[model samples]
Target: MTVTAEREPAQVATLDPAAIAREASPEALSGTSRTPALLIEHLSKRFVVGRKRKPVTAVHHVSIRIERGEIYGILGANGSGKSTLIRLVSTLLTLDEGRVAVFGHDIEREEMRVKRLINRVSVDAAFFKKLSPWENLVYAARLYGLEAGPAQREAVRILSRLGIKESRMSRPVEQMSRGMQQKVAIARALLTSPALLLLDEPTTGLDPRSKLDVQTFIEELRADHDATIVLTTHDLDEAERLCDRIALLNDGRVVAEGTAAELKTQVVRDHGGAATLENVFMTYTGRSLDEDVEEESDDAE
Candidate 1:
């Protein structure tokens, strides 16, 4: 693979807040180029678990390039480090080694800039349960320094588009179904119109109709808002539908990568497996998606 970026400590230190804001603006996001939306180079992370404190390599020197406007999927079974990689890129966890950049901004050195450019939504999204969906979103908007008037309007619009009715907006989020809460999480993440969105198992646990709605909304975001998405999913069919390219991860390493059709072709020809994602997963990961891999160590960070 090509070196996605060279170390630029000096340049990172000199980036002005105004310039960073400008770079993350909607106008800037409108311009498309060959520059990747995300680049991971030799990224690695390990957690110490157990009474013996043995190290478990959650992510092991994995690298991938996600292009602007592309939906890049990371497909893996449980405990395969998909969430760990996403956490590292979102700065929720510190990496043990390697580098990551979001739209040319170094994640470590230019963290604020990177934060401005990206947003993440995970299955276990946290919210103040007592607050209404609208209130929760407005709070998030205020933190992003958005004016209340426009932010509320945009929040309402996004929530409505996600199938939330105005009547439901004012009710405490704790009363809503898990699927509805997930939609609220998605709407909040989109409030800034981020250039890059990290979605970790976004449609997991949703009813079929709700899942389809979210999936359609994701496609719309990429087509209409010039957003690049990095999605992690165990749903092979969903990955085949949404991802421009996918990386199959196993044991914290990327075992295969290609478009869905490309991967199916390879598995049939090379591995003598059925021309299906299920077989591809079985061939590579050596297990079914529903089978939970027990945590090998006593402590997993």
Candidate 2:
């Protein structure tokens, strides 16, 4: 693997007063007065690959806490372990080290409770190709113990909000465009008002318009449903727009974590010039967000 690092100075920018107040007041966001909706303490995961017997440490000892209704973003390049972190919290993969909890319920000790409180939507969401969006959603609802009548009603409502036409709801999911299918996947995750939602590259492979639609829907979900969201994305603009706080991951460790302005300020202070989140990623990870090691290797050969 090739590694590079850039240094930049941090600059401070003022945030709107309303934005500051909204973040400070939890009740203004999440409706419930409960403990933090999600918390991960020193979570870590590793994988072994290749004939040479190399261990790939996907997630290092990382810690994060999200208050109910906060939209936290994990920003990194591909293979920087964003998806692995999401999988660990969602219980799709066992943690090689550390612990995760949802609403104070230990993920390891109270697996069922943690599972019920969280839902994860990945880029490669699986669906019965032959099944219509309505059918897929209904099946998901049933699995979540939601009744058919209410579930169907919610499916239509949420899908419509996501810009999926009412007529398209009954068509085969496989027949829909990738963007439409992604919307349906999101709708499925929302079928039961999960207190915490994990979205892994929810807007990847989308057209610009579709990307905006998904971003808007995510904001709406948090605003209307009071859902705390944890999403991983390679899109820096998306991260800047949607995240209350962003954690930059490089080589399986959190190299930086803060609000956008704070991180930018760090770059300016440390590196001696104006800085942005893009600069922060470049400085710590030593590669453009648009570039990856595999691509570089291919180009070199």
Candidate 3:
């Protein structure tokens, strides 16, 4: 299981549905606010590797503002702090020097509120391998205090949209393809109808058709559910296809950011590379996108 830090500065947000309903107002729960969905100010994190050795700085003074209802992409190799940034925002890891706000609510001061507003789907999602997708999602809904009947109906609706047949939903999750499992992970995360969705390498190991299905669902979520998504991915094409804007991270810092067109234009104007997102990433990071990060082990934390 993924072990988040036990003690942060504030009370951890209770994921129980009753607690969430009691804490959030109608407008806040609706996710239709003028404030940005996410705000990170001068964020930083460091991990001590060994005795008498220098601490590894995983994230360094990164500041970002994501407007409501936008799909923002964070592109990086394995350990360029992409996951670290997401962890911090999701309150998995404590910050060393920064402030994160979700929809104007401080993550530290209003953790419960923040939790009510956002949900995260990691690339390595965990589930009961022997259990069926429906069972797993029903358990999740119960944890979040949802009614079983309504939750099952919603789960079936969502799974069907993601291309999971009713027959397949009854089979063990381990029997399904990785892409199918990933779709189940996404469906489970949406049980609460969170306003801000954090997707970390969402389509990493899917087949072509499955990738398209998941991508289409992401787009639909934004259009129909009023979700503001922060997505991290290794696929440049996926980023270009799904994101409204992109930020390229290198060695724990943002090297460049803009729309796909703007980034391609910047690379051509400044670095004389081909007008493409690949070239933009390569020019800014001084390495090919296919190359793994120099600090790969940091992701295990």
Q: List, residue by residue over 201-284, the lDDT tens digit for candidate 1.
A: 999878998899999998887666646789999788999888878898999999888888878888888879679988888888
Off by over 4 Å in 3: 1-33, 51-53, 293-301
How well is each residue in 27-59 modelled by candidate 2, as lDDT tens digits?
A: 323334444557788888989999978988999
Go through the candidates in order and give each one's C-alpha lDDT.
Answer: 0.80, 0.76, 0.80
TM-score of every candidate: 0.87, 0.85, 0.86
Which pairs of residues collide in candidate 3? none
Candidates, ranked, TM-score: 1, 3, 2
Worst 10 contiguous positions by lDDT, candidate 2: 7-16
Q: Which stretches of candidate 2 lie over 4 Å from their true place?
A: 1-34, 293-301
Best by TM-score: 1
Query: In terms of lDDT, which candidate is strongest?
Result: 1
Q: Which sections of candidate 1 miss by over 4 Å?
A: 1-21, 24-33, 292-301
